[model samples]
Target: MTGLRERKRARTHAAISEAAIALFLERGFDEVSVAQVAEAAEVSKRTLFAYFPAKEDLVVHRFADHETEAARVVLARPPDAGPLAALRDHFLDGLRRRDPITGLNDVPEILALTRMVVEAPALRTRMIRFQEASERALAEALQDTAGVPALTARLAATQVVGVHWLLSMDNSRALLGGQSADERCPAAVADAGHAFALLSEGLAAHL
Candidate 1:
């Protein structure tokens, strides 16, 4: 019964998200209201709020799903592997797969979603908060798993998160500029290698 209820709840949540994204893409994010999203999803305003605390959340929730991903990658790395290596490998894997979060995907819906986030000041601000949370999670992982000092973990997290964000943005720009993912893959791989090598040099003593 509990599993069934959870599954039902997941469906409701997905429905709300899909409906909200569809409407936001159709109309402008600013033009659509929370009430309209509720109506479109067949949920009450209160229920929609229960799932998403703010209007920006209705769009950025997918990003929020990945907020702790870097931390997870660090924690799950092989005992012999370093945190930086795990993250670099994970990102390289994402690029190969054209993961939407890596910003290399050219799917029509993903491109439209990226455009919406870029054009909407509110969404961009929310995304900044998301990045902060991701950094914090990675910092905590470093301190916990590697016994890194608090300050060092935080500084490392800052640099690492900033690097990933910049790389992802570059990939997004290439795709948005009409480059196919396949065309961008080699350059993206080279960029990742260069970025991670730089990070390795800077973080070697600490991480």
Candidate 2:
């Protein structure tokens, strides 16, 4: 069946990603070869490439869903919900759930990956590029939902996404500094709530 085939593909993809992360954490992102990852996952290099096109994708693939998620939230917002309010609610919900995007899911392996990215110039650049793409996707969604000017949508998306990036960096720093998830998550959630509130105040007042 198509569904069964898809599930098998999904499992293979996850196995490759998990193996890639493990090797990257152990040997540094820049030092780990695609062939090495394929071997670790027990898949051929071609198969790995079929799943993730580039080396950067091995780590950043986790973020690919964000673009779709942003659009989906905006498109499905309650009739009375303004764009800013909808995004605020969405982010708050994620924070309460301690989602990784909020920097609350501070697993040791994730922290190691963060350190690897921080130390690698190429990875850092790729992350910035990914964030820009996510912002553009979110901006387009906001523009469609609110019928706002392009600039307004862009500015709003930048503000919200920038806050999220900062929060993720803060959480990574806390974890790298030896803070446990249990110790860091509540504080990160509270801090993110305050940050979103500040953004909401300005966003609601302006556009």
Candidate 3:
């Protein structure tokens, strides 16, 4: 029963969010009001608030998907897998798959979503908060796995997330410049290799 209720709740949440994103994309994020989103989703204004605390959340909800991803990657890695290796491999896989979160995807809707977040001040700020949370989680995971001091774990997490953030932004900017995925992918892959190499002091070192 608990699982069923949670699934129903998730569906409602997604319905409201999908409606909100469609409306925001149609108009602009600043132009859309919570009341209008409620009407579009057929939920009460109060109900909408139950799912998303701020208007910014309606658009950036997807950021929550990755909030603990780095931590999970560290925790679940094979015994021989080093922390940095696990994270780098995960990010490289995301790039190969052209995951939207990696900013390597060139899909039209994804590109538009990237532009929306990049151009909107509120969304960008919210994204920074998400990145900070990811760093914290990664740091905690590193402390547990490596028996490192908290500060050292934190510094390592910062470097890892910083590399990821910069790569994502670079890819987003490339798409924003009107470059097609085909035109940008080869360079993006090569750049990701260089970025990860620098962090791990060369991919060979991580190996």
Clashes of each: 0, 0, 0
With candidate 2 superimposed using the best TM-score fit, by how many Å does residue 41's alpha carbon deviate from the native?
A: 2.5
By TM-score, rank the candidates, best first.
1, 3, 2
Tens digits of per-residue lDDT for model 2 on 78-178? 99877767776887687667677666666666667778877888888888888888789888988887888899889988887888789878887887788
Kindly report which residue pairs in candidate 3 clash with one another: none
**Can you list the residue pairs that collide in candidate 1?**
none
- Per-candidate TM-score against the hidden true structure: 0.96, 0.85, 0.92
Residue-level lDDT for 202 in candidate 2 = 86
Model 3 TM-score, 2 decimals: 0.92
Model 3 lDDT per residue over 1-207, tens place: 999999999999999999998888888887889999999999999999999999998977777888899899999999998888888889888888888888888888888888889988989999888889999999999989877788878888888888889998998899889887768788878888888778777333322
Among these predictions, the greatest lDDT belongs to 1
Residue pairs in steric clash, candidate 2? none
Higher-ranked by TM-score: 2 or 3: 3
lDDT of each: 0.93, 0.82, 0.86
Order of models, best lDDT first: 1, 3, 2
Across 1-207, the per-residue lDDT of candidate 1 in tens digits comes to 999999999999999999999999999999999999999999999999999999999989878768999999999999999999999999999998898888899999999899898789999899899989999999999998988999999999999999899999899889888998889989999999999999999999987
